[model samples]
Target: MSTTSQLAKRFREVLLDGLWIANTNFKDQLSNVNMEQATAKIGSLNSIAMLTFHIDYYIAGLSNVFEGGKLEIRDQYSFDLPPLESEEQWENLKSKLWKDAEKFAALLEQMPDSKMNEGFVDEKYGTYLRNIDGMIEHCYYHLGQITLIKKLLKQKESV
Candidate 1:
């Protein structure tokens, strides 16, 4: 296969790894979490709802860059999620995450292999490929946090 095909396949693999694949993915980690559970705070760490929004915040920003838009994100505001007051609100956040993940994967599939090595936005941010890979790593890092928080919440409930 051509390099472009290989790159596309790699991109899909990373995306799938983040979204599915049993124990590694958010689909199972976020499973059956109600609004209250999501918003539950354990100690000083961020709530699951906040972490979910934070993950999607980065995805949405990078996705804008891939779509030829500017990256309009700020670190200070990434975790500023509104209250997940109801199941409907939590569902909406989850829906947005799934849709954005799909859109991001589609964008990757359409990317030209030649452009992967090009600088993303500016040289300071590194190459497009690096940024994309970073997104996957970032998700997993936060996914671990989310999973731990969920487990802690469950333990608290059981006690």
Candidate 2:
């Protein structure tokens, strides 16, 4: 497979359906979590919903760039999830994440391998490959946190 195709596959593995790395994807983990559980606090760590929004924030931002738009995502507002007071809101967040993830993967797959060596946005951010790889790594890092948080919430419930 081409590099971009491989990268897209890896990206999907974390957010959508592949079970090679963590044995769990965001869709699987977030599917069963209700609004209360998603927004529940587990000590100093971010809630599941917050993490979901955080990742989606970046995914959507980068996707814009891939679609010929500017890179407009700022780190300060990445975690700025709107009030998820109801089940409908929580579902919306997950739905957006899934949709954005799919879009991001599709964009990546369509990219030419030659573009991978070019700088992403500007020279300071590194190559396109670097940024894409970083995103996959970032997702896995947060995915682990989400998994642990779910376990902790489950443990708390049984207590």
Candidate 3:
């Protein structure tokens, strides 16, 4: 395969790791999570609902970039998920998450290697490769937090 194709494949792999495969994928971590569990908190940390929204927020924002849209996300409002008060709401969010993940992965797979090496927005924001890789890392980091919080919530219920 050509170098661009190879880079695109690698990018897809990283996106898959973030969304589905890497042992600690978001899908697996979120399995069996009820709306109540998702909104539960462990101490001062964010709830699973908030964390999930936070993850999707950036993915959606970056996905916009790849779609030729302007970057309109603000970090300060990243965690502002609508209240996940009903099972229907949680399920809707999950549906949106899966759709966004798949669309984001497809966008990455279609990216040219040259574009990946170019600045994502401005020189200060860094290359698309760096931003994509950082997104993978960010997902894993928050997945850990999600798992731990879920465990703590279970423990609290048991006690």
Best by the TM-score measure: 2
Least accurate stretch of 10 residues (summed lDDT) in model 1? 13-22
What is the C-alpha lDDT profile of model 3 across 3-90, one tens digit per residue?
A: 4455444444443444444555677777689999998877799999898899899989999999999989999989989787799999
CA-only RMSD, every prediction: 2.5, 0.6, 2.7
TM-score of 2: 0.98
lDDT of all predictions: 0.78, 0.96, 0.79
lDDT of 1 by residue, 33-129 (tens): 8999998889999988898899889888988988999989989999989877789999899878877877887787778888889999989999988
Candidate achieving higher lDDT, 2 or 3: 2
What TM-score would each prediction reach against the true structure? 0.88, 0.98, 0.88
Residue-level error in angstroms, candidate 2, position 132: 0.3
- lDDT for each residue of candidate 2 in 1-159, tens digit (9 for 90 to 100): 999999999999999998999998999989899999999999999999999999999999999999999999999999998878899999999999999999999999999999999999998999999999999999999999999999999999999
What order do candidates take by TM-score, descending?
A: 2, 1, 3
Residue pairs clashing in model 2 are none
Clashing residue pairs in all predictions, respectively, total: 0, 0, 0
